[model samples]
Target: MKTRTWAPYALIAPTLVLMAVFLVYPIASVGWFSLRHHTVTQPWKNGFIGFENFRRMLFEDQLFWQSLVFSAKWVVVEVGLQLVLGLVLALIVNETFVGRGLARSLVFSPWAVSGVLTTGIWILLYNPSTGIFQQLAQWGIGDAGTSVLGNPETVFPATVVTELWRGVPFFAILLLADLQSIPKDLYEAASVDGAGRWRTFVSITLPHLRDAIVLSTLLRAVWEFNNVDLIYTLTGGGPANQTTTLPLYVARKAVDSHDFGYGSALTMAGFVILLFFSILYLRLSKFGSRA
Candidate 1:
């Protein structure tokens, strides 16, 4: 019995060691850095400073609050839309139809694309002079130079749509996997009971998908909140910092300003916010609870 227990731990020892070295160590380093006055630009000022970074972030930085608010909005909007759209796509693809295999492959292709590539693709598509909009304008649809990314009014929506294009595929793939695992017997039973499609879906399909939906949404929310690549590459949080997220702000702090300590503080703040939101969301949704 002891050998059996020890064997499992021995097998997993390398994995645990790697996690401690890579994940735990980085997180601990960031936490420690957050308490210090460390900036690459000003090496002389690099020293221990307790809670000073947090105080400045909380009380002095308006951009921090702005980025936090945008991060919240970005997560909520992106995750919600991705969930709804992905569920719809999954349901559609789950149904028997011609070219279903091809359709699934095509739809899921976007998820395989890297964030930087997606950003690049969308940048070309959104370019005012040579993009789809310009082509449409040539067809006498609208103005010839409608700068979506440049305009503050349209930038947010445009960015959201661009992200949705790439993000929806991920949710669809996950939800579709879960959908496939659902037994057909439930549907047949519901059909025999004269349950309409809507009723059957409500009573059977949704209940079965509850855990998957909750978990997927939670993960997607966290990803969207921390998502910097697409937004950074596409918008660079430009047009007056309208699309700046917390992660993007941290990136700027670290890269642009060389404020590693303050960046670490921001990173810690993000961790806390995500942790709180995840706990609250899971609790409220009663995730993993029996129906």
Candidate 2:
């Protein structure tokens, strides 16, 4: 027993050490920095200023609140659409058909692409002069010089669609894997009972997929909350900060304003919000209850 216990620890020692160095240490450092008045531009003012950064963020920053609201909206809209579309895609691809292998690969290909590349592709598509809109205009479908990204009225929806193109595939792939793991016997039994497709799905398929759907939604929510690359590259929170998210706000704080202390405080606030939401979501959803 002693040897076994020691061997397990020895095997895991490197992983634990790496986690400490990479994850725990950075988190601890950020916490420490949050209580200070550190700024790259104003080095002379760098020092401890307990709770001041938090105070400013809470009471004085309008942009912080705006970004927080936008972040909530962004996560909700993006995750909801992605979940619906992805579930449909997963179900369709799960069905046995000719060319299914190639279809699955093609449908899932977007999830493998990097966010930067996705943003670049979207930028080209959304461009005013030579984009899809222009091509369509040549065929007399719509007006040319339609700037979707530049117009505030269309920017939010445009950004959501761009993200959905990549985000849906992630959900589809994950849910599809879980869908495949479901025992074929259950469906056979349902069919024998003369259960309709909708009834079988509601009774068997949904219950089986409950845990996966809950977990994936949570993870995708967090990811969308933190996602800055596509938005930054595509919109840069343009058209009067309509697309600005909390993470993008933090990036601007740290990068543009050189306010490390304020940025750290914002980061901590985001972490707390995410933790509270995750816990609340799991509790309300009754996750793992079926298992």
Candidate 3:
């Protein structure tokens, strides 16, 4: 009887220990550090400075506000566009037709690429000297040697396009899985009722995808908000920090400037914002309440 009682705890002990060592410890450390002056470059100044980092971040940091705004914009644009495009792609691929398998593979291939690798591939395409724009210009298009990444006017759209190329595939895959789980009878029933394609889709497909759409949008929003690798490699938050997100700013402070204390503070702020928004989004979307 004691063995049975203790066996479950023993089986799960390793996982609990691993979480404690990794997740819990790191989070606790970040909270602790956020109240200090722990700069690697200025060891002599290392000491407890409770809320000073937060004070400066809140009252004095313009870049902090800018990064937050940009992060919000990036998440909204990316999630919205990815959801729409992904849904369209998912619907298209869900249909039975010749070469369907290959087409689906080709469409979803971008999601398999690493962020850095995606950035590298896009860099080649965005290169002013020998990129697609230059080739188009040679064929009497817009202009020769267009600096898509370098120009501030065009950088945001260019970055958005690059991210969309990778992000949309993720949405497509998730929505497609949910799409497949939907009952054929529901769609057929609508069809038998003399419903048009658009009516059937609206009445059947969208209703069934509501929960999945909500969950996916929330997940994608969080992921995009925290995304750093592709933006870090592709834009480096460049063109006067125009593309910088909150995570990118934190990376700059921690990794580039060796300001762990300030970075921890920024990280804490990000955590709060993400948690708040995630809760609000789930609440507003009525996630998990659908029958």
Candidate 4:
């Protein structure tokens, strides 16, 4: 009888155990390390420094604050563009069109490619002498495409371009699913009632897609916040820290500088920011409904 009563808990025991072993332990260790000093000079010995790391991150270190701001900007621009462009592309492919399959396949293929590869491709494309973008700029679209990565001003935006390349496909596939699920009858009824295309889209399509829109925004925001590989490969937070984001900052501090305590604190800070915003978004969207 006791065994039967605990059966569900027993089934979940492995998951709990794994969490403790992997997630919980590492996080706790990291938190502990963050409150102390660790470096290659004194690898084993750690001196507890209280909240000094956080203090430095908040006040003294301009780099930390700058990286945080840069990350926020990246999130705003990249995710905003992805949401708009992805939805537009999804809408385009949702209609009856020639070569729909080919269009979707091409649009979504970028997502299948890894972020590192995408970054590498963009790096090549941004090469001053041999880049296609540079070559095309001479033809028409202004000199805006000239070795974008090499330019300090364009480095951040240029890095964001790579992220968009790898991420747009995800949004397209998700939004396409939402679009397909909208009943054909709704469109037909709207047509019968003389509702114009734009009106029908505003009234029926957008309303029905609220959940998907919210979900996509939330997912993309989190992914952008936690991103490392995209920026790491594309710019190395480079062209004089123009492309530095929080994740890259954490990697540089911990891995490169071996300032484990500061780095761990930074990582924890990023994680908390990511987690808090995600929770806040879910709560607001879930309960603060339009209805």
> Candidate 3, residues 22-138: lDDT per residue as tens digits?
999999999999999999999999999989999999999999999999999999999999999999999999999999999999999999998899899999999988999889888
* Tens-place lDDT digits, model 4, residues 146-217: 577778887767777778888888888999999999999999999999999899989999999888888888
Pairs that collide, model 1: none
Report the number of the highest-TM-score candidate: 3
Of the two candidates 1 and 3, the one with more favorable TM-score, higher being better, is 3
TM-scores of the candidates in the order shown: 0.92, 0.93, 0.94, 0.89
Ranking by TM-score: 3, 2, 1, 4
Model 2 lDDT per residue over 1-291, tens place: 346457888889999999999999999999999999999998999999999999999999998999999999999999999999999999999999999999999999999888799999998988988899899988999787669998889999999999999999999999999999999999999999999999999999999999889888988998999999889888888889989999999998888998999999999999898888789687857766966
TM-score of 2: 0.93
User: lDDT for every model?
Assistant: 0.91, 0.93, 0.93, 0.85
Residue pairs with colliding backbones in model 3 are: none
Candidate 3, superposed: residue stretches over 4 Å from native: 1-4, 278-291
What stretches of model 1 exceed 4 Å from their correct place? 1-6, 277-291
